[model samples]
Target: MGNILSSHSPSPLSDANPSFHYLVPHTAYKVFINHRGKDTKQSLVSSVYHNLDNRGVKVFLDKMCLRPGQYIPQALICAIRSASVHVVILSPNYAESEWCLDELLLICRTGAPIVPVFWEIRPSDVRMENKNGVYAKAFRKHNKVGKFDSRTLEKWKEALRWVSLLQGFISEGEQGEMVEKITACVARYNEMASRQTI
Candidate 1:
């Protein structure tokens, strides 16, 4: 709930040496937000995080949960596995970052119910249907890098395609309405998760 570091500040893939001793210990979360920080962290991400927090939903947002010296990827993966629901905010530049793609892969692997928020983009774009779109361009750049093998790239693409097929909210600029719908979905899952633990 505080003005902690922005979630986009840490590029998990860029960190050459990932450590764990400095991580801030935390309790279990009900919702794990998998988002492109630059696209939504300041807007929809903050709104959704605060809204769910106000409603007593324990949310895991990197900006609020991560500290300066924590192992970003490990901590994030832990958060993803701990949550009951994952809200993936896919934006125009979502595929540009390897970190975001890795996070998406992890979220898909969790097998938890995902609430995909297609912000300023379509499901087809996310599914790599439009070769000229932002996602395709991003993937092209990644392919050029040679840092990721072909199989890893294919896995990421598959994850994107799979999530695009799920029922999710599309924000065609009406952010408030989108946030409310996402909040409702998250809260519903949180309630279900709470009940299962009893």
Candidate 2:
């Protein structure tokens, strides 16, 4: 994982209208975290969420952001769509979870900018796996049941490939450093976006 700051020459979230980082004002959350909860929820993700939150950056993690209900909160969808940025924590089983993959599919559909954190995985691995039958069987099942259109799966893969190319911080040996960098990046983005409106 690579952590790049404003000096990053190739960031979609930087330079061009960087100050236009406006997120939904209806909620306190500024970032929508898309990750497989079982993978990083209790560990790195939680740490990062707490770090950002402590620094006054609200993050939308499902457990904390979701309303109390048996069904997925509609607010969660709104949060995803309206959030200024999406921090997608990519772990080994990220692709296997229908929940994670479907949320990713939705994030891609929104055309929102993405910040990918590859934890214990490589960019090439994500690219290669997504290109293959990453969620093929589940997609086929969803299609067969008329629950979802499999074509969107292509969009999700495409999104994964695109984000994998971005210079996001990778966490392998020094997870703390990666988390620090990620928190800084999110804070900077929030500052820039908020600046534009003022």
Candidate 3:
């Protein structure tokens, strides 16, 4: 009779092979832009996209790629998950659109970093505490479905200011200050990737 045998967990490195353990290719950092399609012309979203693209940043803008007859929600979720960053272009009408709110909720739930540009609106207008504002209403409705707090809002604001510097929106005298912040963020991401490589 064959000897009785017991199964054992494999060693952590048992399946490791040189070819399989080779360095993963560094893909271009993708950025997904969430904005109202109607605001494409003369909107901050368009301007920021242009600036970043000009600087060789890879960005995914819906207006540039959304195909007709396609399911937008699915396409957007795919893009958001694939992206390294999500840029939300906030305007007075932004909260009025269910699609924009859905996109924001998805970004929040996915734990993807967000950069919210307050275009023609104040930060207070986007915060959840402002119960009477447009953003407040949207947030109130959103809270029923998911968790989002002021900290998340502030994080988005920080990201926005951080990216704005990279786009050269700061004054000539204050440009260095902004550049320092943007460089720090870029350096942090690079360091994270280096650690993963090791």
Candidate 4:
């Protein structure tokens, strides 16, 4: 189910008391998986993508193979815009890639439904302040690039903070279980899409 954007902020969350919300949407490809290819390609990301495909959910991963020196952002942006909901797989190195961050920033800007699956990390660690946080470092690194506009960078940072606060499923170590949960979440999105078109 999608989280209703309330006027208020949610209370502090702890491991013992977690709130999970999947931002389900109504669109063409019931789901769009936002992931870092290097971080989760051979494992969780691949598994989740295939599982969603097997279930006949149109996925936005077709542009995985781009020719050398291609305009990468165009393809990714088009894909994100066409899709209904986004499934953001946050692996350890997710924030390092400019593409992944750009995709996420767009997804957030559109206000689409999202299912954020955290792998090998806790919800608290995804915040912007943790000194040792990989996300924080990678996010900070992106700002140093001179070409991108300052306003766009600010939106990206805001998106990061907003998405991190949304309730989502986690994979401590059980990849199998995580895949199952993600698959189920996609299924829910599909259901929602079907209803909207009716």
lDDT of the candidates, in the order given: 0.82, 0.68, 0.52, 0.67
Cα-lDDT of candidate 4: 0.67
Q: Candidates 3 and 4: which is better by lDDT? A: 4
Error of 2 at 170 (Å): 1.5
Across residues 28-85, which tens digit of lDDT does each residue of candidate 4 receive? 4556788888777788878888898888877876444344443444545556777777
User: How far off is residue 144 in model 1, in Å?
Assistant: 1.2
RMSD of each: 7.0, 9.9, 14.0, 10.8
Off by over 4 Å in 1: 1-23
Cα deviation at 143, candidate 2, in Å, is 9.8
Q: In terms of TM-score, how similar is model 2 to the real structure?
A: 0.73
lDDT (Cα, tens digit) per residue for candidate 2, span 19-67: 3333432354578888988889998899889998999887888777655
Per-residue lDDT tens digits of candidate 3, residues 1-198?
011111111212112233432232322346777777675335455665665666566667777656665455555666766766666666666765556655555555555556555555566565534568766665556456544455443343333333333332222344345334443443344345446668
Model 2 clash tally? 4
Candidate 1 lDDT over 22-45, as tens digits, reads 446645778999888899999999
Model 2: lDDT of residue 170:
80
Q: TM-scores of the models, in the given order?
A: 0.87, 0.73, 0.54, 0.76
